[model samples]
Target: MLLPIIKCGYELCKSENSENLIARAYPQLGKIFQRFAILQFFNDYGEFVLHDVDPNLLTFFRSCLSR
Candidate 1:
């Protein structure tokens, strides 16, 4: 799911019409990439077993990306 989304984003970013499309799509694209990064961070660090990450931090990240 994430792979496809990232691929689409990359394709769009490479397109000739990217300037106009990306300008309008930046917010949505940012949210997708941010979520992917967060998920990847936990997956890479083996933090899920400890479950130590705070939910509030995720919420804060989402809020910041929304802007």
Candidate 2:
């Protein structure tokens, strides 16, 4: 699921001259995953739990959201 989204984002970003890939893809990515219950899954499991599972993923999300 995420792999495909990441690939799509990469392709889209590569097609453009955008400096911030995350910012460009954030809104569309959020909409796609949010409907699939990904957002709910993250919400149900706290950030601490997510960090424990995958610190990099947590960090990535934090960085994207902060932008």
Candidate 3:
């Protein structure tokens, strides 16, 4: 899966809704995350002010991560 640059954040990744990518693409990884009781899969906010990316990308990533 192609991902956005470090400046853009995970929000811009191809699989932002990672609800089933591993299941469809890599079943082993999906099983690992599902079996782990404390596993947490989430997007992340990248360097906003310093990197060349969307202005709202950081905030959007943060909001999604917080959930």
Candidate 4:
């Protein structure tokens, strides 16, 4: 999910000469980049921006709902 959004953003940023990639894809990719940023931020700072919910909620949700 995040991969696709990142790929799309990269492709858009690479393919277009515009400086407004965020505006162009925010509706579609904003959350994706936010998530990626959160993960990267955690890797760098050992914490996420959102503190209201456990960060592991995503992992737990995935584990509970088997594919």
Candidate 5:
């Protein structure tokens, strides 16, 4: 799940930039993008188990990615 998103981000960054800003920001963007992807995945597939999901975990994920 994450591998593909990271790869996509890498490819997008590589294609869009001449500088290494993408590489430098990969960690942050990767975290953000993966979080978004996972949330969407759960929204689409894990709808049945959504009630058991931890809101704090999502917040923590957001915090980690923000840094």
Candidate 6:
């Protein structure tokens, strides 16, 4: 019952740059991951890695490369 609401909150936090918001929502992922290492991967690389890259720019770059 409450899970959907928490997932929604996590999604909202993910779209923003607020680490505090993210941290608050981050614990909700524990049950899904089931492993600390896998969770750590998302914490370290999944969110932070390439976070500064513009999605549109990256898409354009990929298209340019494909051509």
Write down the TM-score of every candidate. 0.43, 0.35, 0.19, 0.36, 0.44, 0.31
Please report, as a residue range, the 10-residue window in candidate 1 with the lowest summed lDDT: 56-65
Over 1-67, each residue of candidate 3 has an lDDT whose tens digit, in order, gives 2223222433433446665543464553343344332222122333323444454445444543454
Among the numbered candidates, top TM-score falls to 5
Write model 4 residue lDDT over 1-67, tens digit each, in one string. 5577568777878789676865776564654455556555666665544453355447434543344
Residue-wise lDDT of candidate 5 within 1-67, one digit each (tens)?
Answer: 6679668867777888746776577578766766676677676777666465578456747686555
What is candidate 3's TM-score against the reference?
A: 0.19
- Per-residue lDDT over 26-53 for candidate 1, one digit per residue giving the tens place of the 0 to 100 score: 7877776776677668768855467755
Candidate 6 residues lying further than 4 Å off, grouped into runs, are: 25-67
Q: Give the alpha-carbon lDDT of every model.
A: 0.69, 0.64, 0.39, 0.59, 0.68, 0.57
Candidate 3 structure lDDT: 0.39
Clash-forming residue pairs, model 6: none
Q: Model 5 misses residue 40 by how many Å?
A: 0.4
Q: RMSD for each model, in Å, please?
A: 5.0, 9.4, 15.1, 7.4, 6.0, 15.1
Total backbone clashes of candidate 2, pairs 3 or more residues apart or in separate chains: 0
Which ranges of candidate 5 are over 4 A from the true structure? 1-20, 60-67
How accurate locally is residue 48 in candidate 5, as Cα lDDT from 0 to 100?
A: 68
Cα lDDT of candidate 2 equals 0.64
Writing each residue's lDDT as its tens digit, candidate 2 over 8-53 gives: 7788888986878658677867755664454456567766563453
Q: Is candidate 2 or candidate 3 better by TM-score?
A: 2
Pairs that clash in candidate 5: none
Q: By the lDDT metric, which is better: model 2 or model 6?
A: 2
Is 5 or 6 the stronger prediction by TM-score?
5
Between candidates 5 and 6, name the one with more favorable lDDT.
5
lDDT-based ranking: 1, 5, 2, 4, 6, 3
List the pairs of residues colliding in candidate 4.
Answer: none
